[model samples]
Target: MDGRKPTLKSSQKVSLLSSSVRTVIRLRRTTQVLKKGLPSRDSPSKVLQRQQSLGKVKAGNQASFQGSQYFTFDTSAQPPQSIKKKKKRPKNPRVLYPGCSRKYLPTEHKSKAKRCLLLLVGIICFQILNAIENLDDNVMKYELDGLEKTMRREVFGQALAVENVMGLLKDYLATHIHNKPLVISFHGPSGVGKSHIGWLLAKHFRSIIGHEMVLHYFTQHHCPEGVPAMSCQLELSKMVTEMVTQAEVEEKIPLFILDEVESMSPDLLDTLGGFFHTNQTNEFLNAIYVLISNFGAKEVTDVLLQNVTMDLLEAQRTTEHLRTILSPVLSQIHPLWTSAEIVPFVLLEKSHVRSCFYEEMMSEGIYPDPNHIERLVSQLGYYTKGELELAITGCKPVVGKVNLL
Candidate 1:
């Protein structure tokens, strides 16, 4: 052996390497193997892509220090997507009925014409008391008598806002008079315009001495036998029909107001439809029937259920969307049974509510703290301006009270 160094055999040299040294050698070998397995770096396009990708990033381009670096993109290269515009909501217009406007707040309609309205309200109250199984005539009279025009309008508006109401109305009408009676279902969410408009039309008709007295106005809430609980629907229906018959034979054509059809069952719907069309069968009761409901056809197809809670003004805004969902409800009714009128129940929305009533409230100093007042006013959020005013002032909201113009 020379003075430089002594050479060992392969096995001996491998054995001489320490554990850490062996690991380093193995890592080097792995690096060489990986390098051989990597894609070729000579491809110009590939090299360019890598460089470009790296160029897209910079250490400065970071959302926060805690997060990893992000790439700065040339967002200007592509224009931002345009956002769809929201539909402009219409303002709250003037209501026609007394208490339909906030203007009558200080002087509620009850104070002006309680005696006259009492008879009309009495008819509704009496029916409702019977429906709720004589909940209490005294209590019913007090509450029913107190219901202003605005309350009816709001409840009717919310009811009308339900989907497929238009189609249902058509169907109900088709099956009833002359095999398509003037009788039709005015189906919608609760507090929609069905009963309200019915009440309005009845009131207007009553205002005039028409051959057909606006005699019987039946609503779901006024179930004389506790029908609101869903268990007593049949009893309620029978009670309603009987009342209509009485109204027709005694006062005028039995104008049966099937209020809150949404609360009734399919059996009730079919039965009512059959009875309305076949009242001619008995030759004793040829009532001019009107079935009102918040149930729409589309609600059947979709698993979701939108409650009948929207106020009058919201109905207008959501009517389109609701209609799509209500297509099925329309299918349930006959085509000819369209609503005599597809009126929006509540004409006033929040913008309208504030504009129509709040300003008036401010002028009158109805309550302290403007902000607080607004907050309290919107607590339920579903009731419309008419309903809200009806509560606040215990009066009906009319078109003249909150004229859109």
Candidate 2:
């Protein structure tokens, strides 16, 4: 009667739930009977047939499946389609001897391969030649040592000069290919071993390079006394050019020594300047030019005497000092002064003169008698006085005087 729905009794509710459960059971049983009577959608025979059809279809068309986006079965277990592998050809046989030429190689060898092989061989040959050159240099250095020893033994009282000249020669040999020719001008008084040193150098070169490579010209001996300067210049110019040209043709470094260079005409000295220029070939770069002169002898003698008297170190008589004192005098006499390096041979002291006398006596196989040596030393005293003029009784006459004694 009220506007609200009435609640059912417990017994009535239970009976209604049982009726619903019975309805569900009856529907399930009807479904089971229908399933047993009808055919299955995925039966084993149908599934097998479907799989065989899929296998026949191409891999490219497998994407046409309706449910491919949501479900996929693995097909990797299937064997792969037939495929072929490429085969490599074998290399052809060819000659292997070192003496065999490229033309004798197998025709199958590529030009690029042949070029690479030749390049490797050429590199090996070049390395061998380089090693040989180093061996030759070692031999030359040994020879140079012998030369230096001979110089010190032969030239008396000029050990400093000998050492300096050796240094210059060593430097020249080290950079002969690129450096300028070494122009050395030996300046000192007469009979002081200047010319003797030059001769020794020439002799050493002759023993090493050959006699034709060493050229010696005593300016006084070559240019006759009282000859006109112009005629002397022309003759000297021709002689020097011919000598250098011949050395070049023979592939030898020329060794030129102009003894008594102080006597040469100024014009002749000027003509020789061109050979010492920096911009020259290796032929001239390796050349050795020696000018033995008596110019600045007095100045050098004075310096040595002063140093000895003052008890100063012998090292004060340096090359730079000699160059400074001698440069002005040399420039006045010749135009090639700046192109040459001046090396002074100091005036021999009394002890040096005594040593020279003893050396000469021993050379003659004479007994080392103190009395005989004393007499010779006394006779040579006058020459060691640093006199401006050449001594008549200097070392030049000591050998002759020792014989008389």
Candidate 3:
């Protein structure tokens, strides 16, 4: 036996090589089929099981050279969802006024800015209104002070009389006692500062001066000559009612002044009783009524002359005493006098008349020499007239006599 290895022929070697190549290709085809059966990233596990079953069936007739067609995924089956954006809402515009201290904001926040501006404007308007009301109150106080000062400084020989009236007014304003109207009657001779005092009051109260709320009736001019007393009373009542209605509408207190009240018919004067009664609720109940008369002129003159003769001060004749003395005199004229307060307009003495004369001369820009003043004083005739005439007249003529000088 020979000791040598056996060797295959060339044709057999070629056949063997072809079979090995086919085996390798078959193994690769199996692997690719398994890979194709796996589920895609987006597909469910149930789809993987269905694909595996279909691959097994297809494997029996599978072609080995199918390229990459089995590996390609169908992405169009589920497209990526489009992202949606939310829309924003629009805003309102801001309004601005003069003198505002706010900064401007962007248009996007205009609604917020408008609300803030409105709040600010409301606050500012409130402050302005408060300041205006305070200013009005201060102005009213100033006017009242000026009125009091003018009365005390301008009117002479009636300090106590003026002060009493002022006290009544102050009490009325402070306490708001509205039970009835303040009825004051001036009882004294003419030119004794009764009319002048009334004029001062009218001038000071500008709201009522020359206004319909203030009714001044001079008996000499207002009384109709031929009219019957009843007719006159009816007409007066109608006029007063109309004035009172107007005053109530305007929220003002009515002031009625009857000058030369002694000359008025008793029936005409009595017509005011309806308004003066405490139980009455008419708008005129809140009115102030002033009656100027010479009913107690003789009594006032007698008291003053007695005081002068005794060299006594006029202050000794107090308001209470004068009131007691004049009450009976006033009651003689009208029954309404019982309800009214009697304020005596003092008779000006010779000194006060002389002072008035000097003041008149000064106002006229005529500086009087001492001798001229003496002559002016001499011209005044106090005792020449009878007691009745003297008691009825007052220092008013002194100004005319000064003019004559």
Q: Candidates' TM-scores?
A: 0.34, 0.60, 0.59
lDDT, candidate 1, 93-195, per-residue tens: 7657666555545654446577779888999999877755543432232232233333433342233433333333323323222332355445433332455
RMSD of 2: 17.8
TM-score of 2: 0.60
Q: Which lDDT values do the candidates have, in the order given? A: 0.46, 0.73, 0.71
Cα error, candidate 2, residue 91 (Å): 65
Ranking by lDDT: 2, 3, 1
Give candidate 2's whole-model lDDT: 0.73
The prediction achieving the highest TM-score against the true structure is 2
Q: Give the C-alpha miss distance for residue 159 in model 1, angstroms.
A: 15
- Residue 185 local lDDT, model 3: 86
Output the TM-score of candidate 3.
0.59
